[model samples]
Target: MMNLQKKKLYTLLALVALFVILFICNMLLSPYHMRIINLVGINIALVVSLNLTNGFCGVFSLGHAGFMAVGAYVAAILSLPLVKKAIILPELPKWLGSVELSFLPSLIIGGLVAAICALIIGYPVLRLRGHYLAVATLGFLVVIQVVITQLQDFTRGARGINGLTQYTNTWWVWIFTCITIYVVWRIINSAYGRGMMAIREDDLAAEAMGVNLTKYRLLAFCVGAFFAGIGGALWAHLITVVTPLSFSYDRTFSLVVMSVIGGMSSITGGVVGASLMTLVPELLRNLEVGITVGGISIPPLYGISQIVLSVVLIIVIIVRPKGIVGSREFSWNLFKKKKWNTMNQMEN
Candidate 1:
């Protein structure tokens, strides 16, 4: 119990320190670079949220993008200027057209909308196990895509919705990222989180031990959807546009890749993986090879960074299936304790 308390305190302190550093960086960095960092932060939120269902609860949900779309559209609509929305979405309900909100409130409302949708969807889909669940969720994604496509008045259909104010910044992104990481870390260390882990480890055993399988699973699913929705809102605001295709299978695959490469069980791993993967392609795109080495000029493949990253991910999975950080979390004690003990010894 003492050790657990100590570990918890250490974790809290570490989180605080990390947030402070990220906040400072956000303030100091240029908008362009900050945008990249913000992308990493948002991806961390998305990946970690997905891990609740995929890693802790042992559910395979390929339809997180659906929740994202719901959030994006909801938040976008709420944040848009009344006059501009009137011009773009002329047929919108008067109530919706009259309402406007700041970024944070819109994000929360978006999350709530996504959570409600998840609750409704999870009722039937969560009953299926393994591959059936995967397929069912994939179908849900398709259904969402179709709905977005058909919602011509609200979503702008295939033409997509644009002219959104770019309100998201590195500060907002990192603040939310820290909140997400801390919230998830707290949950995973709590009894509810333990129950989810138990279900993941052995569903039958967890059921036998009096864990409400359906309730916990649905809770995890809802929480995951809520955060995914938040991420979507941030993304929509950052790009100043909302498109149905942005939340399609390709986007889902990228989120899945971050979770997998980071090691599903490791929150730190997820954040690190998301950051690395988000930046790598951009870095590759900017690389200029003007000189030839050994008479071989390095041609830029443009799209080859993704392929290289994918191959590297495959090799890592084969070699260290547990991911880069495995289940290890950041520990201030590990670094601070030794120095403290040495100081004591020297004084003695």
Candidate 2:
């Protein structure tokens, strides 16, 4: 017990130290670097949230982008200055046009609205399994995007809502990222999570074993939606815009790729995948710009990031089908096991 407590203490201290260093670095780094890190943190929230449904719960949902869109629009509208709201959404109802909120409240309200949306959508859609469910959820995404485009009074149509306050910083991103990781990790480690995993493994078997399929699946779906919404709100504040284009199929695909590459079943994998996905495009920016070496300039490699991502994804699917980490969660036990093995080898 004492050893476990000590381990927890050590982990907590290490995380605190790491955050301190990261905060310091954020202050020191260029705006580009800060933006990248902030993006990574937002992706972490997104990847883990999606991981809850698709990975742990074994639900194939393609509507993450849609939920995010809901959150982003709601939060942006609430947080937009009243004067700017009139200018941007002149057609909005008097009640909505006059309303303005602080950042945190807007963010929370956005997430809640998304959760409500999930509840409404989950009733009919959660019954389907496999590709059917996937298609259905994807349809929801399309429908939401279309609605946003049509509702010029509410969403400003294709033009979207801009001039949003930059309420998202590295601190906000990482704070939410940590909360997402903690919440999802705890839920996955709980008995209800075990039930969800059982459903994933075999829904019929899980049902036969007395696991309530509808209840648990809805729980996971709604929870996942809630966090996705929060992530969307964070992203909206970061970008200072809420366009339908921002939450398109491409965005959904990116989240899917992050979850898959990181090992959807593992929280640590979510972080790893999100970090890699966020960093890779930035790291490859030179490819998008001409590279000059030895007085010879090479033409820019447009779309190279996509090509690299595809190639890497294909390789991972072929070689490590379960992902970089599979279903295994990272632990200090790995180090302990290694030390024990080393001692045994020396004794031998």
Candidate 3:
């Protein structure tokens, strides 16, 4: 028990340290680069949230982008300046046209709206397990896309909504990322999270052991949707635009790739995966080849980075199926002990 308490304390301190370092980096980085960091942070929230259902709960869900769209649209409608809407969307409802909120409140409202939608959808869809659930959720994604495309008055139809305020920055991103990581880590280490793992291991056994499978599964689904909603709102505010096509299968693929590459069961894996995937392509864009050893001047293809990453992910899965970190977490105990040893050696 005492050892468990020490472990918990050490984990908390490590998380604190990680946040401090991320905050400092955000403050020191240039605005342009900070935007990329913000993307990394948002993706971290998304991938980690998805892992709750897909990783810990062992449920395959491919429709997270639908929740994101719901949040983005809700937040966009609520947060758009009244004057801007008046000029752009004059035909909007009187209530929508009259109200405008700041960034933070808009994000919260968006998340809440998405959570409500998740509750409605999860109640019915969560009843289906495994492949049936995946197909149903995919259907939901298609339905959402169709609805968004058809909603001309509100969502601006196929042309999409524009002229949003870009209020998202490094500070906001890091703050939300910290909150997400803390909340998820705490939940996963709690009884509820443990019950989720039990269900994942064996639903029948878990049910026999008094674990409420349906309730816990639905809870994890809702929580995942909630964070995905927040990520969507942040993304919308950052880009200052919204298009139904943005949350399509391509987006879903990217999220899946990040989660799988990072390690499905590890939160730190998700963070690393998102960061590397998001930045690698951008970094590749700047690479230049001056000379070729074989007397052939070859410039890198624009999409080579993605192809390489795909190959790497495939190899990782085939060779080491458990992912780079497996279920291990980022903790301070290792670092603290190393530091203590180094100090003792120096003193001696």
Measured by TM-score, how close is model 2 to the native structure?
Answer: 0.94
Give each model's whole-structure lDDT: 0.83, 0.88, 0.80
The sequence of per-residue lDDT tens digits that candidate 1 reaches over residues 1-348 is 126577667767876887787788777888787788789889999998998788778888998889999999999999998888999888888898888899999999999999998999999999888889989988999999999999998898977789999988877787788788878877887878889989988999999999999999999899999999989999999999998898999888888888887877767778877887798877865544333679987775666666777788889889878777666654444465542221111110
Best-fitting candidate, measured by TM-score? 2
Over 1-348, each residue of candidate 2 has an lDDT whose tens digit, in order, gives 126766687779978996998889887999888998999999999998898899988999999999999999999998999989888899888898899999999999999999999989998999999999999999999999999999999998999988899999988889899899889867876778889989999999999999999999999999999999999999999989889999999999999999999888888778888999889888887677888999999899898877887898899889888778777776655566652221111110
Instruction: Give candidate 2's root-mean-square deviation (CA, Å).
Output: 4.3
TM-score of each: 0.89, 0.94, 0.87
Write down the worst ten-residue block by lDDT for model 3: 339-348
Instruction: State the lDDT of candidate 3 residue by residue for 1-348, as single tens digits.
Output: 125577677767966887787778877888778788789888988988888878788777888898888889989988998888887777788988898988889899889888888888888998888889988888878888899899888888788889899988776777788788778777777888889889888999999999998899888888888888889999998998998987887777788778887777767777877887788766765553233558886675667766776787788888867766566666544465542221111110
RMSD of 3: 5.5
Which candidate model has the greater lDDT, 2 or 3?
Answer: 2
Q: Which regions of candidate 3 fall more than 4 Å away from where they truly are?
A: 1-29, 288-300, 336-348
